[model samples]
Target: MNVTLEQARALDALARQGTFAAAAKALHKGHTAVLYALRTLEEQTELVLLDRRGYRTRLTPAGERVLEHCRKLLEAERELEAACAEIRAGWEPTLRIIFDGIFPAEPLLRVVKQLRAEGAGTRFHVSAEFLAGVEAAFTRDEADLMVSVLPPTLPDLRSYRLADLKAVLVAHRSHPLATQRGPLKDEELARHLLLTVRGSDPRLQLSTGALEGRSTVHLNDFAAKKAAILEGLGYGWLPEHLMKRELRRGELKALKLASGATHLFHPSLHHRAGVRLGRAASRVVQALTGVELPTPP
Candidate 1:
């Protein structure tokens, strides 16, 4: 109570982000201003908050205590504001969701629409990227919330399970091997050209030795892989959601590789581990899924 909330917040921002410049930008001030404020705060409290070494920043024992108090105070303040808003004017305020290309647009869009219908005045900014693009974006702290194929968890990152996507082999109906359906045997593929995503994950499923006699084409991402197939290059496995239009329009047809031979890829919602999620992310979590990822205690 000796220190103002602004001082506590500055300390929290630096501790959570691990960089002075980043914390400064987030607090809407210059790096020098943050430095000056923290210096003043520490002088007033007569305690060290940050253990700074060259460009690296870390919280000291005292700083850690300050951050804990800061988070509690901030959460209380936010809850108070939300209570007043809920009683006075109904709204979620803001939301930014970064998603993978595989999750499909319609379903996620529908979720956002449903939230609005519930009187949640949420503004949604949906960023759709290919698998790796979205993953990279999340890692870079560019997205508030993420929906992507599960990757190895990164430090200071938490995830929630969303749904599963089934991938299947696809081809133009006029292809020679189009008639051979119902859990395709690898033997049958030797006669048809093959298109697959270029990566260790995709390669693990598609072996070079297995495709020895087959004509193979590897592309950067799903969009490119789908494009290669559209040009009649080769048959490629695609996400169930991406091929909905083609499946319905007879432009592309899905072939079952094997009965119950499903690849159950998980789509998960992810957010920064320690940093608290903002209003938009919270609303999306509550509205779309009845789940909220707990922040570090």
Candidate 2:
């Protein structure tokens, strides 16, 4: 009940560093001080937090549970400090953004580079998620911005469309289907393997251009899918921007499919409607959407 931040920090360091000496070095404290902090923590909490019986000190099961809560406390403290820094600096401490994996990364990197050149102080955490995973990550992380293919379904959301991404069904130049002239028949497509990206969200049955009865191999990202296709392992849809050089050089050939050779995926940038944008986030929005947003007051 009376545990202090010092005690929690010592426990965390011990768990991470694995030994009293290491933990002490990490905390910039003497070994005795680190031991005392952890002992006091155990006394105050009435829990045997560490098991020192073995040659190596380890946390008891109870210690692990307490450490979890302690980690949350430490994280909240860090967030509080960041918030204060943001207030003084007039930039968000960090901007968390999640974008669809199908969307090209070059554009995002260009925006980030521009922001860095302009002396934006906000730190960036960017991730690419597939299908419903994009929205799930945005909500779970309370992300400041998201680029997603899913349309905004919530009333509290604001969205603007970016350029549509083009996905082309492709096969390796040496694959049997690559030589076929006319639109590929369903029966022929069925015989060949379809390389597809597995959705980042595990709970959802999300996929694109997967034929009903074809044999398929699921990969984690477009890069892997492209690799597999180029290796002649299978044929699948890949983002056009990703394989232009390969297509032009005959390393990969776009499949002429009966259903469709090309698929257009529309992605939009979204943020919470009522929340004011920080300077960095606003600049990023302008870079992506070409519409300047007002910075938070």
Best by TM-score: 2
Model 2 off-target regions past 4 Å?
Answer: 1-86, 199-214
For model 1, where is the 10-residue window of minimal lDDT?
200-209
Question: What are the candidates' C-alpha RMSDs?
Answer: 15.7, 10.8
Candidate models: Cα lDDT each: 0.70, 0.85
Q: Report the lDDT tens digits of candidate 2 across residue range 1-297.
A: 876789889999999999999999999999999999999999988999999998779999999999998998899889888668766766887899999899998888888888888776688999998888788899899999999876755578889999988878889999999999998887788888887677322232223334634587889999988889988998887889999999899899988866678877788999999988888888889999999877677
lDDT of 2: 0.85
Count the clashes in each prediction: 2, 0
Best by the lDDT measure: 2
